[model samples]
Target: MTGGREGRVAVTMPQLGETVAEGTVLRWLKQVGEAVADQEPLLEISTDKVDAEVPSPAAGVLAEIVVGEDETVDVGTVLAHVAPGAPSPGQRAEATGAPPVEPAAEERSPSPPSGERSSPPAGGPRHRHSPRVRRLAHDSGVDLASLTGTGPAGRVTPDDVERAARHAAPEPVPSPEAPVSVPTRAAPQRVSTAAATEPLPSLARSSAPAANRAFRTLVAEVDVPAAQWVGSSDQASVPVPGSAAAAVVAAVAGALRSHPSLLAPGAGADAGDLAVSWSTGSGTTSCLLSQAGELNVGGVAQRLLAGATAGEPPPGAGFTVSLLQDTDVLFEVAEPPPGQVATIVFGTPTRRVVVVDADGSPGIAIRQRSSVALSHDPGTVSREAALAFLRDVVRRAHSRA
Candidate 1:
């Protein structure tokens, strides 16, 4: 945009990835003196990982054009500027205070849905999210239906986007569990699969006059939290070693695929989105939690598991849904159980663990920024039997609640 004194606008093509070199300038969102609002759609960009739209920083005349359309520019390139008083920068340093640039929707990237890669690890068992969050997802075309968290104690994080992309880039050959490379022609047109990137949906300071720095999120109840189940020294207390945890993860993933909206608060709002992850700490094992600024656990998870069934595949696009975290504490989003309340329990060859929740609680026994932990306990009261009883209680409570 024009940099003259008459206009105080500052526009730039913000970067989406730490490693992305260049992106195609597919189109522009605004024109000269467009009377734009802060964070208004200013342009669109199509990169190797995403085809996204950018928002304007302020409301003002688009006085000048530093770069014409169709020019492929490096990150931090000066494209245009909005005049002063038009907009203010957000506290979020990540946002460039500009709109999306470059073309969009031309080609889909091999990125993980929403990038759960940066979330939690998936090498162990899976956890649960909300079901209500799933139902609302269908209406938005966004998927809360399938994110894997990797935060402390298996919580999800915004950075999971990067991890998700990396997971989506390559598929492992099943037989030997090895990375497989296919010839370009045999595979769908693929871009860099291993690089990390982000979707910067930053709003201009001027756009949100009422919501300057902080906003409130939604609240939810766990109703009946998770618990374990068993009968008669039961169905093989543990699966084949690592298989039990895998099954737990698979079950949780099934829930996410059935539900979608657990990822966000409402249509188009970003902050309230839920995050799930897992980790291993010094004392015990745990799942970390970091809620969306405005959302509660039940509200998000309830919507996420509305239509899902046990065998159906989870949603794997637009949002990150995978075991993509680097540390043990992180995990991808698992499935949300149906009903107002849900339950979970784990039994190993030698240990039994059960977690409980009430209607008002999200069922998380412990909560923290870094983790909500559980451990491999071998010495508890009637560990195995207690585990089974708790699971049944949670399931019934959820159904009745």
Candidate 2:
């Protein structure tokens, strides 16, 4: 956030991730000359890592829009300007040369560029199809130019392409004896279990450019005695009745505090106040815990219990943890949610026979173990940093157990 001329504030494109160099302005929530409150959502922007709403820097009237919807610009570029104090409609119009309120329908809908196919005469309006939408249209054998857009400012969204595809006549199926010619294109990367239920078309509709980003998954096996420790009621050292799941969450939070670099590069300097999104059976829940590093296993358990009972977790977290303890899943690769740096998944713990070093002597023993996998955007979190964070989590979990 920066100050501009005439006591106005500049709303620049924010850095959504460490490797995100640019972003596209998807929509402007507040039109020019519209009164905006401080920290109010001013616009929505899409980057490779996430799609997020950019908030206003100050309470004032939106004086000017330097960047329009669907326009891509470098990070830190001024997207708009807001003048402090309430200025009259006439004064605002004179200062910015924009209408006092929303523009007329005709003025709002601009003509498509030359060489682009124009919409049919009976169509709603001209629209700009994003690359993902165009690809989906091509794959589905749907003509984007002929479809009516339902998105903001007449944008051709993936839904329109999917709808068109579903309505179009199906092509004849090739016989078993016929030869097939596969298109020469790179295979699409697999989405994580978190999004496995969603259709490909729906995934394409996501604001984050998942196809363009590089992701890495790391897996580690950890010995967890917390499962037994939590089940036992006779332990005198137990500060509070906590579940193994809550202990894992506390361990991850502590690791995040110790290794700040494991967080998204754009996650600011204060790592103590971190938000973590965790998965319950019903759905995902986000919780913002202050000084999370300082929280113990019992403290985290209480919070989790409260959130589950209330059906709402604390809002805001750039990290996610998915617990698949009850299932037979051994390990899973989970993609981080949009705008988040990484996701940690815990698989079901099982008894395993292994050799252990006891008092400097190797011995055969049966132990309980679980596989923890960390999926992260390599651009935001380095491989080494992720490994260290995972190791720390296991270490902390063992100590707590």
Model 2 lDDT, residue 52, Cα: 92
Deviation in angstroms for 33 in model 2? 76
lDDT of 1 by residue, 1-401 (tens): 12544546567767787777676676665554334556666677766777667666765544456677788787777677665342222311112335424223123221223333233344422344334333322222223325655766655443443234223322221122222222222312111111101111111011112321111111111122232111112232211112223223333333323322222212122322222221112111112122322323343333233311222122222122111112232211122211101112221111112244577664534421111111111111112222332333223333432
| Global Cα lDDT for candidate 1 | 0.32
Give the Å shift of residue 299 in candidate 1.
39
After superposing candidate 1, which stretches have Cα over 4 Å from the reference?
1-7, 85-401
lDDT computed for candidate 2: 0.60
Each candidate's lDDT (Cα)? 0.32, 0.60
Superposition TM-score, candidate 1 onto the true structure: 0.23
Model 2: lowest-lDDT 10 consecutive positions: 195-204
> How many angstroms is residue 285 displaced in model 1 relative to the true structure, after the best TM-score fit?
59
Which candidate tops lDDT? 2
